[model samples]
Target: MVKSHRKDSVDAMKNAAEILAVDSEIISRERNKIEQAKYNLNQLNNLLDDSIDDEIDFLEQLENSLKNPGDFKNSLLLEKLEIIGSRQIPNLEGISLIDSMEISYDWKEAVRLNQEYAKAYQIDLKHPFIAMFSSIELVEISKQVVEEFELLELDKLDYAFAASAGLIAGFIDAIFVGSIKSRADATGLQKSVDKAFDKIVELYGKHERIAELTNQQEKAKTDSSKQNIQNSIDKVKAGIVSASKNGKIVEREWTKHDSIKWLEKYKKVGYDAATNLKDGSFHIPGMSPDNHHLLSLAHEPSLFGLLIGIVDQITGKSTFIGNDGMIQRIVTDNVNKELSGNMVTQITQACENWFGHIMSDIAGSSGSKGRGSGLPVPGWAALQKLQFGHINYSERHSDVTIAELSELMFKKGYDVRSFSAQLIPVLVYETLLRCYWFYKQHFYYGKDLKESVPIANNRELARLLLISAGSFSTVDVTHAIIKSVPGSPQFIAEFIMTVNLPGLVDLGFRSFQNIRNEVSHRKHMENIYENDILIEYNRVMSDPSVL
Candidate 1:
C-alpha cells in the first residue's frame, strides 16, 4: 500500500510538471507571436505612408499636365487617376488584427484552471512540493508595483482622518500623560506603573527567604530611630541568598558585603569614582549605590540584565560606562572563586540571585525614605552611554554631556516606572491611527472586517502611521519647547522632563527607514521581476517534461 501511494505521488508530480511545461511553451509562443505582429504592423504603417506620398506626387503631375494643354498626354492622365484609385485608405482592420493576436492571462482564469487540474489528479494543492506549481504569475507583486498601481493609495479624506487622529492623540499625550517625574505621580500612567511594581514585589514574596525579609521590613517600620531602621535593612540585605535545585545556598557575592569579605584574597583592579576610589573592591565609575540600578547594565530589570549579571557573578567582574564615556570593566576580588556546586549549579544560583536582587531594587531598597531609586527602564542604560551634545544650563553647570543629563534625570525620579508612564501617550497615538485606518478600510472603502484589520504588509497603513507619528512628534516637540524656554532658571529640568526621548528616537528611526525604502523602491521592483518572476517563467519553460 505504501509503495503504491508513493508511486501515485510520483506520477501526480510528473503530470503536473508536464502541464506546467506545456503551459509555459504556449505562453512563450503567444508572446512571440504578439511581438512579431507588432513589428509587422509598424512595417505596414510605414509602407502605407509611402503609398500615400506616391499618390500625392502623381496627382500633382497630372494637375501640371492639365494646366499645359499642349503638353497633356491621355495615357499619363489615366495612369495618375489609376494610381489614386488604387491607393488603400487607412482602416481599423489592421489594429483589430493585432488586438486579436494579443494574449492576456487573467489571474481568476489561471486559478480556475489550477483547481481543475489539481482535482483531476486528486492532488492537494496545499502540499509543499505541489503548491509552487498550483499558481502561475505573469507579473510578481512588489512594493513599487503596488504603489504604481495605486492599490493602497490614500485619498484627501484619508489624509484628513489620519492627521486629525494624530492631532487628537498628541493633545492627549501632552495633557493627560505629561512628563514622568516620579513613580508616585498623580498621572493615570504612573498609577499603572505602581500597580505593576506591586505585582512584582508580591511575586518576590513567594520565595521563603525573601518572605522573611519582608517580615523584617514590616517590623522595622514601627521603629522611630534611623539607626534601628538602617540596621534592619542591612540585616535583610545580608540574609538574601539563592537556593539551587539540590538545595545548596549560594550567597550573592558581588552585591552582598559579607560575601565580598570571603573574596579578599584576589586583588581588585579598576577605578570607581562613584564609590570610594581607594577601596580594594569592584566598582563602576558614576554608578553610586543610590544610582547603580540606572548606570550598571547588570542591575537592569530585564533578561539582558539577568544574563549580564550571571556573567559578572561567575567571572567576578562589573561592566559600566566610565566617566570618559567609554565602556569600563572591573575585576573584583571574587574572580576565580566558586560560590557553590559545579559550573551549571553556580549559574542557576546566579540567575536566581539576579532576579531576587532586581526585585528588591526595582521598587526601592529597604532603607529608602519615600520613593527610593528603582531599576532603570530596560535598554535605558545603553542609551545613557551615548554622551554626545554639549548643552550649557548655567555658568556652574556648563558643558554637561548627554550621559550626565540622563543620570540627573534618574536622580530626579525618571526610573523604569516613570518610563512606563511615558509609554501611554505613544500608545494612544498608535491606537488612534490604527482605529481610523480600520474604519476607513471597512466602512468607507466597502471592505470586509477581516481585510480591514490594519495588519500585515499594508503600505497604506505604514504610510498613515508615519504621517501620524510625525504629527504627534511635532506637538510633543512644541510642548517641550514651551515648557523649557532657553535662559529660564528651570530650563534643564523642564527640558529633560518634557521631551519624550524614546518616542522621538522611534520617530526618527522610522522616518529614516521610510526614506530609504522609497529611494530603493524601483531597484527592489526590478530585482523582484528578474529574480522571482522571470526566473520562475524560465524554469517552467526549460524544465524537462516528466511525462
Candidate 2:
C-alpha cells in the first residue's frame, strides 16, 4: 500500500512539473507577442519615411527625364533591348519602379479603397500614409513639367500631354486634399478632445488641488512620500505638456480647412479636343484602353466613383476617380508583427487625421496665375456633404446581428451605439463581466453545493478570484471567472441581464464598469466570436434603447 501511494505521489509531481512548463511557455509567448507588436509599430514608421523618400526621388528623376526626352527614351530603349537579349523581362526578377501612368492609376485606386474602408471602420482615411503621398508627388512632378516645358516649342501631341498631365495633377491634388480635411474635421476623436477643454478649465481653476499637493510635498519626511510627491508633480507637468501639444496639432489640422480656397481659382487649361483619343493622339506605348476610359470619365466630377472602378482594374489596385491613379507602395517585410493595443487605437485616430489632411490638401485648389476656366473645382463643403453621404450609406447598409448588439454594450463609451462597426471590444468585455459575476454568485456566494453547478474542487481559489475581480486588469478577472466556471454557459440567455431581476441587473452593472476599465486601458479580447454569445445577449437586451 505504501509503495503504491509513493508511486501515485511521483506521478502527481511529474504532472505538476509539466503544468508549470506549459504556464511558463504561455508567459514567454505573450511577452514575445508584445515585443513583436512594438517592433512592427517602429518598422511601419521607418518604412513610410523610406517610401516617401523613394517617391520623391522618382519624381525628381521623372522631371529630369522630361527635360531631355530624346536621351531618356534612347536609354530606356537600350535597357529594354539589353534585358530582351538576355532573355529576361525587365520586371521579372524583382520589384521595379512604376512608370508615370502606372503611378497615376495606383494613386486613384488607393484613394477609392481608402474611402470605401474608412466608412466601414467608423474612421476617415484608411489608406496607408505612404500611398496618400502619391498625390503630392504627382502634383510636384506636374508643376515641374509645366514650369520647364510649357513654353518650349514642342510637338503638338507632346505639349498637350505634358500640359494635360499638369492640369490633371492639379485637379486631382485638390480633390485629395479636400477629402482629407473634411474627414479629419468629422472624426469621433473630437468627442474625446472636448474633454481637453474641460482639462484646460481644471488647470486654470483655483489651486485647492495644487495647494493640497504642495502641502503633502512639504510634509513628506520619508523616502516613499517624497517619491510620491515627485511622481504627482511629474504627472501634472506631463498632462499640461500633452494638452499643449494636442492643442497645437489640432490648430495645425483645422487651419488647412482654408485649403478649399484653392478651388475658387481653379482651371483646366489646354485644348478641349485633347480629352478625346481620336481628335488628339496622346497615346503613350504602355497606356491601355482602360486607361483611356479612366481619362474619359474624368470630365465629370460626380463620376469620380465610376472612374475609380475602371482605373482600379488597370492599376490592379483600388481607384478613387474615373482616371487611373497610382500610389506609392509599402514594403511589408518587417510589418508582420502584431500591433500593441495602444498602437491600434493610436493608428486608428492618427490615420483618420493624417488621411483627412492629405485628402483636403489634394482637393484644395491652388491660386495660380495660369488657372484654367474649364471645370468647376469641388469645394470643401461639397466634399464634406459627400463624406456625410458615405457615412449614412455605411450605417444604413450595415447588417446588425445579435453578436454585434451584445458586443456594442462593452465598448469604451456608451456612445458606441452610434457606430455599428465599433462594437466588438465592448461585447468581449460584457462577456467577461457577465461570466465573472455569474461564477461568483453561483459558485462562490451560494451555500448549497448540489444546487449550484459543480466547478473545480477548490475553495481558496474562489477567494483569490474574488480578490482578483477587484483588480485593475480585466483580463485577470476574466481568466479567474473562466477558471471558476469550468462548465460555463454557452448561451447568452444563461447569463445575460434580465429586466425583472434587479439584483442580477445590478451585478451586470458592476461587471459593465469593470469592462469599461479594461477598454479605457486598451485591454483587448484574445479570441473573437461572430454569432454565438451575441445570440444569447440579444434575447436579454431586447430593447434597442437599452443597448
User: Against the true structure, whose TM-score is highest?
Assistant: 1
Give candidate 2's error at residue 207 in angstroms. 24
Error of 1 at 35 (Å): 38
Q: Residue 492 CA error for candidate 1 (Å)?
A: 3.4
Give a tens-digit lDDT track for model 1, residues 154-254.
78877776677667767876886676666345366565675677555644433333344456556664556545545544644555434355577554422
lDDT of all predictions, in order shown? 0.63, 0.33
User: Per-residue CA lDDT of candidate 2, range 1-547, in tens?
Assistant: 9679656545443433333333343454466666766666666667667666655655665677789886665565455445434542122222223211111134346444434433443432322322233456657866765544332222444333323432332232222211111112322322233233223323432122345467788998998998877675665544421224745622222112222221121211111122223432443322332222112222223345224322322223321121122222211121112222474563443333222222322222223111111121221112211212111112333443332322222111111111211222223333443344446557666746443432312222222222222231233223334433434442222222111122223235545654554453332221111243344444533655532
Give me the overall lDDT of model 1: 0.63
Model 1: worst 10 consecutive residues (lDDT sum) = 263-272
Q: Tell me each candidate's TM-score.
A: 0.54, 0.14
What's the TM for model 2? 0.14
